[model samples]
Target: MGKWNAKGLELAQKLEGVTDEKAIKKLATETMQEIIDACPGEGSIKRPRAALRKAIESVYPSLNAEDNYPQGYYRTSEGKGKGERYEHLALWYLTTNIDRWSVEGDEGRQQYWGNLPTLEKTEPKPQQTKQQKPKQKETVMSQLNLDLDTETQQALDFALKQSGLEEKEFISRAIAYYAKSIANRHEVDFATIPTEKLLNDSSLAKLPGRAEELTRRAVRAISIYNDDIAPENSERWAITQSAIARLTGGRAKSIQKALEDYQGMIADHHAKYELNNYSNRKSGGRTIEDTINIAEL
Candidate 1:
């Protein structure tokens, strides 16, 4: 059996007679929290959750299918508030399977439960030879030559003077900010439209006339931007502005206006559809639902 399966069996034996659902959930939550606290890094909870779930599944095979479990047994919602109900179910199964797990051997039990073995206990490093020379220290910093345009050079000089920071420090901060901005750029290539379409469409330069079309494109970009980008990053708004500018061939001011319009439109759309069931009723001889499909957007 796999490590988690064996661990699950062992856990089952230990949790024998613990039939209370609340008790089982508390034990599982505490176990996971302990693992997360011990590791103290990214994926600490995620890795242990996955392992524990696998172990639980080994004991209760019915959990693998939605039909075998109650409604909302896996997730509680469709959006950000969705809860992991399966984790609790998995823990309950482990407690109930004590008889089945008791048959497994005690081998490998020390590796997972109780105190995790230290690195030194698991594997020892090789000793250095007497004749071997110690390695030389490596350089930690790298030097780069930059060819800045007149405008950029002046900006950098002004920033350095205003901030009272060293030239290297100012440049380093600028580079870091620029790198993060570039990273926040739209993950999807202009909402899956070909680059050539936006770049080659010279007619997009004519603004105000094609403002509606521009707003539609901005809506799509905003939808994708919100889904992919984190709200905490201030650069996210700038990145979305840049995307709209590229898509519509418009200036910063024009793109900003388009974004404002897109936001208002989205709010109006949601209010109409949700409050009035506007999609089901007719308006101006046609159903508003037929006219506007937010899902398509």
Candidate 2:
């Protein structure tokens, strides 16, 4: 209703699932408190009792009763609509926005559940039958704004027409081609996180999957940063970092450094490796997994 509450909702988007009711509530309370701290004029100091939960519920409204009351968690809910919707929302959101934090209960093997479309958790995956169905690839949607000169646009349109493919498909192929053939020569501009420290020396299981997940997030952020800027001036990326940042509302210094480093990588690549077309002609945009893997590369 007020500034603090509105900010509270924005903060709630950052919440991943915690283990139990107590943890969730504590997280919710902390989130609300953060909003209150940030929005001094919102007068959230007098925010109602359980106001934090109410604010949090605004984000995950299905949260109802805790599976374990008092000492336990606010993690589980019993009601049909609220709880079910929460599960669906969480699964869809986490899988698509893999960069987002995940729930406590949904870690470990449960993380694999993200691969499925439905919220329904299957029983422990039965022993692999000899006759295994091909896994279906999940889908993700991204939107972009791009600009091109009339001639380039005409060329793009002509190519798409000749290929009989939609804009997204053509774009996907072009991006894949450029990355593999053109962009793979040099070191990336950003550093990736190391999860080796997370690995247990004694446990054969080694490190938890979260390490890989964190790496994926870092990779995604860099990929997104590169993709989101100056589509029209792509050819001049080496010399146009300032323009790119101005257009994209990003820091010019950062853009300059990334573009220069990437260009250096390309220049260096020319010395050692021949360009690789890596041809595997497909009809359209790849599966979501393929897209993510390409970005990682």
Best by TM-score: 1
Clashes, model 2: 10
Q: What digit string (tens of lDDT, one per residue) describes model 2 on residues 1-297? A: 765566555546655544354344344433432332233232334453244445555655553343323222223333465452233222222111122222344353255445443323223333452122122101212234455678986786566546544345557777876775444444332224333422222221222333234333333433443346324322112212222222222222333344543555544432333321111111362212332222233
What local lDDT does model 1 show for residue 118? 20
Local error of candidate 2 at residue 74 (angstroms) = 13
Clash pairs (backbone) in predicted model 2: 17-103, 17-104, 20-73, 20-74, 20-75, 21-73, 21-74, 21-75, 22-74, 186-265
lDDT of 2 at 239: 17
TM-score attained by model 1: 0.23
User: Tens digits of per-residue lDDT for model 1 on 224-261?
Assistant: 54346425332122223333433444444454555665
Q: What lDDT, from 0 to 1, does candidate 2 have?
A: 0.37
How does residue 184 of candidate 1 score in lDDT? 50
Q: Note the Cα lDDT for every prediction shown.
A: 0.41, 0.37
Error of 2 at 241 (Å): 18
Task: State every prediction's TM-score relative to the real structure.
Answer: 0.23, 0.20
